[model samples]
Target: MMSFNATLRLAACLSGALFVNAACADQLDDIKKAGKIRIAVAMGTPLFSYLDEKLQPIGSDVETAALLAKDLGVQFEMVSVTNAARIPTLQANKADIVVADLSITPEREKVIDFSRPYAALTIIVAAPKGTVVKDYADLNGKKVGLTRATVNDTMTTQLAKGAEIQRYEDDATLITSVVTGQVDAFSSTPSNLGEVMKRAPQKNWERKFDQKDFLLGIALNKEQPRLKAWINTWVEAKLKDGTLGAIYKKYHGRDLPANVVQL
Candidate 1:
């Protein structure tokens, strides 16, 4: 027969185990139980998420999402989105997080929560091969295409106050309009320009302008402090281990921003 002392010991062990399980389970639980985290990103190539020639999703953001999921101990699900709609998507519950090339502006921060700035980006004007669009001055009285509802669209208008502005829902359409002679030139983010150049290297588009934007950020529900805190910490850890720099090289083929070391 078992002694009474042994029975008490067994019960205490079980109680402690239950408390440990409860304590160890929080954000980690929400992710696993849901099976996937909705990650928002643009569906393109080179810098952000994109399909390779073989149709595999390959980009710095995609890779980063995969690694983040691994670190969080959950599966990752990507939600293809546009620069204009990313915030609404998160706010509307269409996506759980925004991992796109989202710039953290004070205006944007008023509506959404953001992770620590990841990278600094710039906006530029790119023209097709042999076109005369050179700089902002050249764009005067010219027709320029930009992505609708993007920061670039507004900046383009301000820079080319006298120029005709054409707006599209996304980068692909805007670039297409420029490619097919529908517009004189296209103005967009440099990371996106890099993707366009990779897709059509023979076009030999020259960047006539550059607008240095503040750091990029990841978006989450404003109330999700736990998840937001975790992402912020995760980004810091990646920076610590050189993973951020390595990821940048894998996609952009170079080092990070001058301020990355400080990040």
Candidate 2:
């Protein structure tokens, strides 16, 4: 009943649709078929992801990533990245997912999908006890250091208006800057400041003020609906089983917050 040219056109349309569907196939299946999962980790971030004495990667994120791969029955590949490279590495397909300490923010959500809160971080302004930085106003004209592209950087940039903000590429560099007197103060987590204190106990570094507490999540490309859903379910299971809490306590010396575990 159909004319020859019309039949050809219909066939072409169907073929095009099939090609598009194949091109947009679920990434999770691809990962499974590949027999490995590449996870992006921002190393040098103590308590999150960092190198061990043997120069092997070991930390909360590293362990979490390994667990994910184990659950998936795949090999684990660690893609080391700097703080600023976490999202970009995922976008570039250099990593399948990011287990780095990625904070959930509206701006970041626009570009990547995130699992439910699996952990939390509290940002604070830390300075030598003698520095007298009790509030944002106190940072005026003082040099403040923070790792670039972190929540600390965002909070300090937004609130510490008059402070001279110095950005470091990584946590180690920021800590070194503080130790060498390159910064008057720095924005970081309490655990990070504790590391700095260990290096310079006489300075008696203390938190000047709490900036904000953020919910950290695992990140992946926005298009992977199946992977995102799976990660969410996995996170919930880990939280309920106390697996995540144990990992947090092992490194952070404290249990995960009730709100984070209850999420």
Candidate 3:
């Protein structure tokens, strides 16, 4: 009993509803169809993703993401961004996910979403071999150099505000400052500081700290709830399967401490 005009209006309404459904899309499906899971990782050595002798990328984060892509049924693609640009990169849709060592902070929570953290990396103090900075007590008034964008600055300053805190642009510079006697010690996460120690111009230079701080998380935009859920679920599965611990040991050369908690 509908007239021609009524039929046309009904068809248009149905098409509009379809368009609305399409607009509120599922990014996971899009990624799978593209056949690759892209990642935004901070550039560095031995800690996150890094370049190897063969000029191929290799590291804990890199290998872990590749495995995650395999589990997700897609190829892995990595893009480098800095700490400052990390959130912006995700917000701008420059990367599908962020696997860098993103510390979960309440301030950051307002704009970005984070996956359940699978790893904990807090800052500690590094001293050259034979330097007696074995604990917080030994750092009363020493000079400490810390890399920016890490938990180091606050940790160092809080433990001993009497001590001088100098922030650097990168890990290499902070380590160099400690090595060259420009600073009494350096501070950064275990992975970064450990990597610097491993490649120190001399052997046996290392850090000492009694307490750890925060766990790192995979940051995403507020809209990517599905991606956040996927990473959290995937990380939990890896931990249960022992693949998570195995991969960390393979790169870090030790087991994760039992006391270290994941979120």
Q: Estimate each model's TM-score.
A: 0.81, 0.90, 0.77
Q: What TM-score does model 3 achieve against the real structure?
A: 0.77
lDDT of 2 by residue, 1-263 (tens): 23364344445444676554443356788898999999999999988888889998988889999998999899999999999999999999999999999999999998887899999989999998888888999999999999999988988899989999999999988988988889999999887898899999888888889998899999988766557767888999999999998998899999998889876
Tens-digit lDDT track of model 3 for 1-263: 23364344445444676554443355676788899978887765455667787878777778877888899999888888766567788889888888877778877788787777766666667777788987776876777777666655656677777677787755656656665668877777677666666666575667576456677777766654445557878888887777877877888777654533343
lDDT of 2 at 139: 94
After TM-score superposition, the amount by which residue 60's alpha carbon in candidate 3 deviates from its true location, in angstroms, is 0.7
Q: What stretches of model 3 exceed 4 Å from their correct place? A: 1-24, 129-142, 157-160, 201-204, 259-263
Point out where model 2 deviates above 4 Å: 1-24
lDDT of each: 0.73, 0.87, 0.70
Between the candidate structures 1 and 3, which one is better when assessed by TM-score? 1
